[model samples]
Target: MRCVANTGRMSRGECSSIRAASDVGTAVELGAVVSQWVGRVVPHEGYMLAAVDPVTGVGCFLAREHGYSQAAARRLIVGDRSDGDHPYPFDRRARQSRVGVFNTDAPGLRRNEAMRDVMLDQGVGSELRIALAHAGTMWGGLVLLRPRGARPFSADESVQAQRLARDIVAAMRRYAAAAPPEPSGLALPPGVLVIGTGGGAIAAERVVAATPSAREWLDELGTRPADALTTSDPPVESIVWILTQTVRTTDKPAMTRVPTKRGWIVLNAQPLTGGTDVAVTVQPAVGTDLLPAMAFWHGLTPKERAVVEQVLEGLAAKQIARRLEMSPHTLNDHFKSIYRKLGVSAREELIARLLR
Candidate 1:
C-alpha cells in the first residue's frame, strides 16, 4: 500500500488503476496493463517488459513494442556486445535500485559502440529502466524508450517509475503464491534430464540426444528445437538454450531457475569436454534450491520459513515448537501467518507449493 511520491501530474484514478492491475492473473496481463499506465504517466514511444531469471539475469519471457532488430535484441538479451558497456547495465542496476534512466546525450554513451548503434537504429534518445525486484531477487524488468529529441526522463519521473515497479513486484509475488501446484501426471522425478547443444547459425544449432524427460522439461519452458525458427521478433529461445549457449561461448558453467506451470525447474549447463557442445541438466528444484525465492514470493519471514522447513521434514507441531524454542501458541501463530501469506490452508498444501 505504498503511495507514489507526489508526482504532480498523476491522477488519483491512475494510481488506482495500477493497484487494480496488480491483481491481474498473469505476468503478460500485468505487462499489458503497465504499458498502458506508462503511456499516460511517463510518455514513452517504445517499451520492453521481461520476466527475467534472477540468478543469470537472462530473460525467461519478453514482450516489447517498437523493438530493436532481432540482431540487436539478441545482443542485448545474451549480453553479446551490448550490455557490459552500457552506462546502466541491468545486472549492475539490479544491485543498486529499482529504477534508472539512460540518456544518449550522456558523454560516454555515444562512445559506446553497442549503445550508439541501438539508439541510432531505433531512433531513440532517452531510456528509462526499471528492475522489478522483491526480497533481493529480481523477477522482471520494464524499459521505456522515447524517440530522439524527446525530453530526457527526469529524476522525478524515475521516482514515479520506481513506485510503479514496486507495485508490480508485489503483484508478482501474490501471483506466485496462488500458482497451481506442479502437475503430478508428468511424474518427472527429481533427476538429471540431459540435453546437448551445438552452436552456430540458428539452423545449425541443434539439440542432440535429448531424452523424453529433457523434452518434457523443455516443453514446459516453451522451448523448441533450435531449428524451429519462429516468425517472432527477437525469436524465442528457452532459458535452457540460453544457458547452453552461454556455457558454450564462455567456456564456463551456467545455471538459471525458470518458473514453470509445474514449479521452478533448475537448468544447469556445462561445456562438454572434447567438442563445441554444452550439456544442460533439467530437474525439479529441491527445497534448498527454491527456498529463498519461495520465501520472497510468499512474503514469508525467516521464522516462518524455518517453521515451513521443519513441517516439510514431517515434524510434529510440538517438536517444531521445541526445536525453535518457541511456545506452542507462538508456533501456531507463525503457521497461521505462513499459511495466509502463501495462500495455503494446511501444512500439506504448503509442502506441495514449495517442494514442487
Candidate 2:
C-alpha cells in the first residue's frame, strides 16, 4: 500500500495482518512473519526480508521466495543470483539511502526504478516501499510489490505498514538486549590480583590478608633465604622471583611473564605475551593449548606454510600474498585449512598458541 498518502490509517483486516505479522521473536519466527507479511502486502511474483545489525553494520537476509511472494523483488535488493536474470537494484550503497516516506509515484522511485523493473522482469507490476527506522537508525526494511494490473498499496495500508515497522524495531531491540554475552575464551582459576602504584602497598597488603593464598605468598616474601639475590635494578626479575617463589610451594603454575624495560621475561615458565605489545593485545601469543596449535597446523596447506611463516612474522596477508605471488583467495583457503587442522575456530587461536 502507498504509505505516503495513507494518512496513517488502517482497516480492521489490515490491522490484524500487521499485528499478527510483526510479533517477531526468534530469528526463525521473525523470518516466517516477515515472509507472510510480504505475501499479504506486496503483489509481486516474489519477496524477501532483511535484518541489519545496528552495531556491526552487517546485513543478513531473513527470508525469500521466488514466484508467489515478491521473492524476485527481494533478491534484486540483496543480489541473490538464483532469481534468474533479474538485475540487482540495491548494493552496499543502499545503506546510505536517505530515510523518509515517499509516494509510489515519486520522482525518487522513478529515478531508482530498477527496483520496479526487477519486479516487472519477474512478471510483477507495481510496488510500495517503506523505510523502517528506530531512534533515527535504519535497522531493517520492507518492500511490498504488486503485479502490473494489481492495485498499489492504498494510503491507509501504507500507514499501517509504517506502524508495523515501528513495532518490529522495538521487538528487535528488546530481543537483542536480552541476549546473553558470548564467552571471552580465556579461563582462569579463582583468584584476584592487586595492581597499583608502589604507594598502594597497604591495599595490596589488605588483599593478602583477605585471601589465604595471598597471605601465604606475602608471608613468604618477607622471609627470603640468604641465597636469594635481592636486586631492585631489574624490576621484572624481582617480580618474577616473587611470583615463582610463592607459587612454587603450591601446585598452581606461577605467573610466567613479567614486564621488563627491555621487553618481557619468561620466568619459571615461558613467556605468553610474546615480546611485542601488538601481539600481546591481539593474540597474547602465550598461555594457549593444544587445540590452538592443531588449528594453526590445520589452517595451512604445505605450499601456504611459507606464507604463514611470514604471517607468524607479523606480515599482513596482502603483503604476504603479494610477496608469494599468490591470490588472497589462495591465502584464505590455506587459513581455512589451518583452522580445520588446528581444531580451533579462528586465527586468534593460532596466534595465542604461538605466544603461549
Best candidate (score: TM-score)? 1
Summarize candidate 2's per-residue lDDT along 56-133 as a digit string, tens digits.
222322433443333343334333223333222222223332222222343223314554455556655545455555
Model 2: number of backbone collisions: 29
TM-scores across all candidates? 0.75, 0.35
Per-model C-alpha RMSD? 5.3, 25.2
Instruction: Give the backbone clash total of model 1.
Output: 0
Off by over 4 Å in 2: 1-28, 35-46, 66-75, 78-108, 111-116, 174-179, 183-356
Q: State the displacement of the C-alpha of residue 105, model 2, in Å, after optimal TM-score superposition.
A: 10
Q: lDDT for each of the candidates?
A: 0.62, 0.39
- Model 1 TM-score, all chains together: 0.75
